[model samples]
Target chain A: MSDFLFKRMTLIGIGLLGSSIALAARQKGLVEHIAIHTRSQATLARAEELSLGDSYHKDVADSVKDADLVIVCTPVGACEAVAKAIAPYLAEGAIVTDVGSVKASIIRQMQPYLPKTVHFIPGHPIAGTEQSGPDSGFAELFINRWCILTPPEGTDAAAVDKLAQFWTVLGSNVETMDANHHDHVLAITSHLPHLIAYNIVGTASDLEMVTNSEVIKYSAGGFRDSTRLAASDPTMWRDVFLHNKEATLEMLGRFTEDLTALQRAIRWGDGDTLYELFSRTRSIRRSIIDAGQEVDASDFGRHIVEGGETRAEQLKSDDHKDTGS
Target chain B: MSDFLFKRMTLIGIGLLGSSIALAARQKGLVEHIAIHTRSQATLARAEELSLGDSYHKDVADSVKDADLVIVCTPVGACEAVAKAIAPYLAEGAIVTDVGSVKASIIRQMQPYLPKTVHFIPGHPIAGTEQSGPDSGFAELFINRWCILTPPEGTDAAAVDKLAQFWTVLGSNVETMDANHHDHVLAITSHLPHLIAYNIVGTASDLEMVTNSEVIKYSAGGFRDSTRLAASDPTMWRDVFLHNKEATLEMLGRFTEDLTALQRAIRWGDGDTLYELFSRTRSIRRSIIDAGQEVDASDFGRHIVEGGETRAEQLKSDDHKDTGS
Candidate 1:
């Protein structure tokens, strides 16, 4: 076991990301001493209450005084302030990273504030849920999920490798990319999907003809799925959009344009076009299933829809005839 | 038990809707014998393989003979043909209903072909799975869902009452409404949601910049939900749009206008408008929960994003709760 890879790990903003790291670290035995800190005394106290760390502090300098690693886990908008707050605190030779959803902006915001001796490696874990706070995280949230790290030029390779190991122990499939590319990919994969969900749910709620009760009652599977993303922590998401405005806007532009094409197709009464488009989309669902990220939950999850046969039956036939269909 | 409300029930299509009715009727003992008929031999055989009915026939006329109730369960496009085929052989005083999604057009197409001896009532069951065919249904699929009945003027009260009781026995909440209005309401709530889901999935699949693996690997709760709706049977949905064109087009127009406004807001970085709209939608999810129609599957049956009530409890007292206060 590469357990106790670090003697001490300091965390800022003991919220979802921070607490999840703590749990994963403990379970994986990655570090000996977990130092949890937050700007709010209340949050710090809550993290302590949750037993999320061996040490809790509201002062970053003192918290990082003897730490071997420090991870900033705040809303993207607060990176600068946190970087400033902890600049003097990040220890020499220590690798400092973040678990923000937006990468480029945080790198820009934190680079200037970091001490020269500390290695600043920015990361965005492409994982989360509709909930937030210290209590909302688990050791398994990052399992099989992607974590992209954007290290600046001249960053120490050994330090980057160590941080990557930490995330890998936490069950992340790590990808190293430039900060810009990280933002761009996330804009399409994570950020824009979230924005669209929130927008559609908002649109549905505002409709005069469809009462709120009706939307809820007949939400079926479609609306329910949209709402899961829509139900995400609002403050965290709002800050993400604000921080990653350019990338998010670019993706949103593409999505809206595609949607407009669909609108036009519907307006023209083009059944062939609509059918073709609908058919193409159905295949993506199969791809998602093949990747093991999702299963066919069907509507209402009332029943698992697959026949649970074909392949197994094929194997049986192969054994019986040593021969073919 | 009000079971055997019909002496013999004939279902003209052995797909999802038709199969569901067979299972529900069998479970509730709602009819003496279920007579299944479809256009294809394969489906008829599969229905037999699934024990979907006590009686089976390939021809509609032979299937409906001596039946006390007939359900035109084929695609909406086939309703007129099914009606024409079954009308001459139906027993006197039989009540005919359809499980088509679009009510107005189904009534228009089938009403003229039906014999005056049989009562004609059209219905839309606001419940389904992404799966189709005889083997895809269960007895409990209709539980706690809705069935909307659209009957033309002077349609017998006795006939409507009997159909409502049948749906009620199947564990659905039955509501009577005008055919046109049923189509309009469903256009937004059902049709549009499915269309948008299919469209977005298709759009995402076509993007040259995003790999299928990337979309699937990070496919979160949102995409999974959308895909479930998108994966619905193609022929059924194609006919739905083709049949319910006017109302769906009208609702699609409204959705497009709203979406465009949202696009503009995002482009201008209008956080207030975006936040306001987002905040409003959360209430709809709550209502859905209250109505017992949905569960919060945010962790999505994977890792519980966080265990327990810690996150939700914290949000109630969240500092941002005072934002804009």
Candidate 2:
């Protein structure tokens, strides 16, 4: 795995995902020379301070020049400008990819601007934290996470393989799916969840009956979990909704319809409907845990117990102590 | 704290909350004897096996006999019946309280049945995990969490203080507020968040274009967090929504209106509106962390780190190595 290497790798943004790529690539020795570019000079300086890349460039063209792999890590709205800026500077036969949340729009945005000689593979690592900036990234950010690649039909198979291998070396399991299917899947899994979280937190904040302080204090009751997704980068999520409008809106429509039905059930005291839905959703959480997407923790595993006992172990200890008594 | 003692404490339902009270009371020596009773024989057997109380009774009358303190830990919908059954058996001057989420509704349902000789305090502990069972009980479940007590006007202050002291010894911070206000606060803080979680997961599960496996696989992108709340006990949540109908419906209405506004923003490509709401929600997460309700861990502290280093420590180590390099 250590033999996997690229002569030069370019990243176009230095936010959480971008800096994470830099850190993971560096730690894994996937790229010998890393070139970084960001639109903001302050961010570029921050990346330079963190030494996230071997070289820092103010211009996207300069960053991609002679690079074997160029990963555009900007917000989805900026995909076209970045693609156009680096199109001429990209080396022949270089692999051009992205880490954007939306795949279809990214392909539509960058396909026309990119050179025919380059292998344009759009990829998204289904991983992130709420924090942003170069300082927030770690080498292990992508460990055991999924990275989906959406290469257009008739694209070079060898190019797709190379990009998949790159993500593999960075500790992500790679899968390839059609761009449209990827958009729909992500709309339900990522975009819709984030939108609901942001909306709920916003709704709670605007409540005249519940003070902001009370909301914060009693957040562990459940509201705080939604806040994690709501706290994501506003610019990135805004672009995601804008670029993936059709799919996002479709999912949001379904969500709103379901929510309305649930509202009626609550209003009508239809406990059976609420209970059935709640019971069914519980299995989904179990499936997620079994599928290795979520940790099998009780209450997000926040117990400060010594010896690092897991929730299950803690429960067992309670039973043991009770029986002993 | 060790001096605090109730001669006999009766727990009417030996589920998650009932068993937890038994464990915590015993752990802190807050009660000399605990009498446990549950209508379901299976649950009662399980509670008795766990030694959750000093004595287990098949009948509610037997359990509450001569009990100086009686805590009803049944679902909100069952409060009136449990109050009725125990009213005949409660010792004079007994401090009778409940752990129902909807305080106003519980007060309404139980106030008439509970004798004036017994001080009835309707209360809610703003703490729980998705898991619920007799086996899930632990002494530390309430540590640093808020417990709200809503006693009727002219109720015995001494009894209320005694109950508060009991909860304080069991590791909770107690506050007294009006029953209606408690219902309103809980509707936003707990009930509505849960309903939204259950609704979104239900929506995702019923998606025509996306398969259930796909939603489960890519859930780490954000969907999995919501599933935690959705995985909570169905029976408990059904009662919560039914008992807290007015406040729950009010909050749900606001949520739907805000969600509609957000949907319109997404449809019209209103980036500023999306960004503003997203930014405002981010600070609430920070406030939750600052208020000690949630950790500052990225992704609700659900990282699967093998080396036992926390996410923050791992990020720091990356920076340390980078600067050293």
Candidate 3:
């Protein structure tokens, strides 16, 4: 009879993910009430200022007391402590989930503390911008993005479906997979890319021959792309690499090995190898565009967004005018 | 009394840069007449269809005949052949320049064949999208972008000034530097970032553990940023790496060294080192935005372009509405 998925939803951390979930859930009327709790009192105060929740609590236990759904939105490293703090307070039959990048480690960190009365499903919404904090979140951040849920074996089907429906209404395409597979997949798709981006930005800044001003001024030439990822939250990314160590290192190793081969090709003037690899990689982006994961516009559509017209749009208009000519 | 920068301007290749120069020059009325030439007749025909130039030539020498300015816009590898082809036909006292990524190599490849009667100034505009070819250009591509000109010393200062004025009128801030210095600056800013992007995309696609579809579907995490750069023209990138071997290799070495250290930090669970580097790199992107090299909007303003409202704009509107509430 009730349209609400949960009578009360408790968000344990009020960072980008937590605040976004708050804004999205409230905007969609998916929950009757949101009880917010954060380790930092300042963040809690900020959440209240933004009206991100119906009730704000400095005590984690107080926040989860009557919640039928509890979401931990913290750095992967903080999962254990959050689970330990909120475990005794979570209502019977409540659904417990997280929005961490790594799934297996999250399960390992929180599983021991969580009571068997609640259905524990770990989820990672594969969505974010480089910016972080409560002020940086929005209701539409998850629109058309993928939210991957990794529930342990024998979890209640109804609970999982309810969570999936909740995310669906929040404007995400949800996929359920094994915890380990989610980690492995994300290690390549997200973690490795962030690592490489941060690494390259660090290298560019430390260069003595090229001044930092030069690097920043001419960043439009490919380097600025990496800077977006490199500008991600240090604390969150640090926890990601540390928690997802095995898979991150595995993908990173492959990346470095491929990079070494590319270096050799550049050194030996092997245009064929460079051309072959470069050509092959171009199609992957096209596939990403076709798959609806990336915008098809050139330069991520920055020019269109800034200038009000892309070259493709201009060409289309030009063709129309040429018909009369 | 005429306002034209040149009576006739010849473009030696009709790709992204060449076609863009033609469009921008024509739109700005910088030149009286434009001559376009390319090795591929198909591309030449495309340029003609687009009305990119007043004249189209299948023969490179014919394109340069009676031209007061010649811009070779082919891949750096073809600079030598282009120089040799246009040398005899180039008008006396003409300004010969190139839009190559690598300056020193462009000079080496082009200066020998260019006659003393011409002023050879090598220029690189730090502006482009991933798209290529005649259709992928627009008149506004050079606006607010930096164009570096590396004119050899002891050349006619007036000629260099004339060329600088041309770029200035084309909506570029022109800076003059030595060819070697130009190579070093671009090596870090453009070449290295591209190589890393191409390398990582290759690594992601070749992984046996992760399917290509998974990478494509979930690329919004971070990998999609790299794909934009990886989707660039292979022939042009190959020529860039091959032409700027020394500086590219040097930057690659530094990047690898830094990456290895970051890897060690991750491997050893050294969160401080990771945190420090990640936090420091965040400021560089901000500086780039401040310097007008990158869009200040989150996610490169993709959401604003697509949805017509960014989160920041939404927050501002929300604040105004909350004043009375």
Q: Per-residue CA lDDT of candidate 1, range A265-304, in tens?
A: 6667667877777666666666666665654344423222
Q: What is the overall TM-score of model 2 with all chains considered together?
A: 0.95
lDDT of each: 0.74, 0.84, 0.88
Sorted on DockQ, best first, the list reads 3, 2, 1
| Candidate number with greatest DockQ | 3
Q: Please name the candidate that would achieve the greatest lDDT relative to the true structure.
A: 3
Tens digits of per-residue lDDT, candidate 2, B239-314, equal: 9999999999999899989989999998998999999998888778777877777754666555533333254544
For model 3, what is the C-alpha lDDT against the true structure?
0.88
Q: Write candidate 2's Cα lDDT for A1-325 as tens digits.
A: 3464688999988888888899889888788899999988888888898788889998788889999999988889999988888898899999999999999999999999888999999999999877777777777778788999999999999899989988999888999999999999999999999999999999999988889998888776788888888988888899999999999999999998998998899889899999899888878987887777766556666653222324344542213211100
Q: If both were scored by lDDT, which would come out higher, candidate 1 or candidate 3? A: 3
* Cα lDDT, model 3, residue A130: 81
Q: After superposition, how far is residue B84 of candidate 2 from its true place, in Å?
A: 1.1
Which residue pairs show backbone clashes in model 3? none
Q: What does candidate 3's lDDT look like per residue over B1-325, in tens digits?
A: 9999899999988888988899999989999999998988778888899899999998898999999999988989999998888889888899999899999999888888888988888999999888788888888889889999998988889999999999999899999999999999999999999999999999998989899999999999899999988988889999999999999999999998998998899899999999999889888988888888887678887777557345654432112210100
Report how far off residue A220 is in candidate 1 (Å).
1.7
Number of the candidate with higher DockQ, 1 or 2: 2
In the range A236-301, model 3's lDDT, one tens digit per residue, is 999999999999989989998999998999889899999999888888888887777776577887
